[model samples]
Target: MKTLYIDCFCGAAGDMLLGALIEAGADYEAISKALNSLGVDGYTLSCEKVNKHGTMATKFDVHVDDAHDHPHRHLRHIVEIIEAGDLPKEVKEASLETFRRIAECEAEVHGTTIERVHFHEVGAVDSIVDIVGVHLALHQLQPERIVSSALHVGSGTVKCAHGVMPVPAPATVLLLRGVPSYSGDVDGELVTPTGAALVAQVADEFGPMPHMRINTVGVGSGTKDLPDRPNVLRVMWGDAVGDFHTKESITVIEANIDDMNPELLPPLLEDLLESGARDAFITPILGKKGRPAHLITVLADDKKVSAVTDTLLRGSSTLGVRMRKEQRICLERDWKHVLTPWGDVRVKIGTYKGTTSTTSPEYEDCARVAREGGVTTREVYESAYAAAIKGEYKDA
Candidate 1:
């Protein structure tokens, strides 16, 4: 399948992402036209070929000629600006979604609602164009998967709307919670909040570049030309050598606790699941003291072991937990939208050797429907599952 691999060696920004796409064979003229269609004037895009550390790259510059920097904007104002734009429906929707993700990240960091969140640099005209432009370019590519290298958030401090702050900025840090990142010798805000939001929203996997036939390469130059490092973002597009297969070992943890309050089990299980446990549950057990206990079990990948274990220890009254590496054979999974009485639920269909094996609705989606429809989560899940099965048969 066709795929795009983003080499974030120098870190990524909204403009850098767009520049990389343009370098990777995206039509500059077409993209410019699309940006203009948004009806936001006072900004211009300049594209050029430049060399970074002896490597040739495309550099896209979004120039704003205002005498003073644009002030921060509220989430509603930003949304209104996007809604007023004359871009295509898909482009508009994608851009809005990216902005929404940014707002949500900011809200979480500042402990405020999304509507009350204000964007600083991200609300500027140039940044908005960069974000919306990147979305449009990505939609044009439509690759099967998008992957990125671990982000390099530079060291030291940077200025923001909130005054001088440490490198990575609070909002950017919040946006990159689950993504792999690190700080290096470089000293600056390498990854901006807008950049982090975009990557976190779209990146399917975070690791080394996968095995693919290199078709195109693009390099986006950053504003600062660091003396020691090439300030650029690399985008590579190609086809993988073999059928995509992910191979990794996982750990299964189990512990029996007899003294925990039964009422706390539900919240504890929720915490574990949210903390990256693949699965968590409790089973009734008769303890050695002849007292009743609940057997807590968790399945998680190695990277999540600590958080999973911490959740168990902090949320439950378990004295000790046992963990062991277990061999797990998992089929390839894909998502499909299934229409149910409550709403549309995303169903995950698992296939082994090209044959369907298992199907389930996403828990969050089912739970939302359950709350809305005043029914058990199982009821919503079963309804969605049945609908998916019917749809699969119809397709067959």
Candidate 2:
């Protein structure tokens, strides 16, 4: 699968994302033409390479002519502008959703209803261009998945239309709910409202850089240069290259239990699996005094680690559970049905790259067919394997 990882060490803005995407191979002319079709007046878009500290990056600017007197618009006005544009349907919907979220945030911040909210800076021509251009660029790139790093929301107060407020303005604060963010070393508004909204809308997951083969790296410069670090956002376009599988980080929880009944272990395992454990098993171990103990181990995704741990603690006689992280690779798998003389057996096909590496017939299907045919399960399995090898499966 294709992946795009956004490195927001300096935080992200809409213009920065657009610039980085364009540099990462999104067609600039397509983005420009799409924006021009909107027929919004009094603004011009330009992109150029610039140096920030020592790293060269693209600077995307939307120069708006204030002399044209663009009016402060409401949420409905912005929605109308985006709806009238000739762009991708998904792009229009995403842009509209972004504006709606901002309107909601603003409404909450100012104690007004969404309909009564008046957008000041966000309704301006530059912000509109930045937001629309970003969606256009992302659509052009067409990555299968998009990931981002934790945002570095800078410290210190920022002066806005609402007067001096905290580092992340009220609207930005409201927009970045549930997203991983921190007060960065540089003191300024690192993440803008438009940037925060885009991140919330587009990023599929947030953490460290994912395990992807980096193909192209594009850097976008921020407006201000920071003291200790380069103020730039990086867009990495790459394929999720793997040996035989994709990689992900998982948590392993283990507990030593000698007091619990071995007969109850199966039920405890069932509960753990039901509670979101990827895998659960027990191992025989010698305790400190040579007593035989069962080591209960569970593999879980990060989000489900707590639940798995709770199940281990509550369902077993273990006082505490120890946890650790592990990196695991999973083969891409799909189901195909292979026809046998008795019945159809579903087979799991595991692939690496484009080549099939392994195949396994559904044991339950084989067993059922074996009973009906008065044959051994081994014989049914053999027939299924032969059918699979003979390409008896209907679908790929």
Q: Judged by lDDT, which candidate is best?
A: 2
Candidate 1 lDDT over 137-160, as tens digits, reads 887886666888999989999987
Tens digits of per-residue lDDT for model 2, 1-396? 578999989988888888898899988888899999887999888999999999999999998887887998899888889989999865786687778889999999999998888889888888888899888888787765678999999999999888999988889999999999999668889999999999887886788877777899999888988777788999999876565227667789999998888999999999999776889999999999899999999997654575677788889898898889888776656678988888889998777776788889889999999999999999999999888878789675
Off by over 4 Å in 2: 243-396
Q: Candidate 1 — worst ten consecutive residues by lDDT sum?
A: 239-248
Q: Identify the candidate with maximal TM-score.
A: 2
**How does each model score on lDDT?**
0.81, 0.85
* Candidate 2 global lDDT: 0.85
What TM-score does prediction 1 earn?
0.62
Residue 267 of model 2: what lDDT? Answer: 98
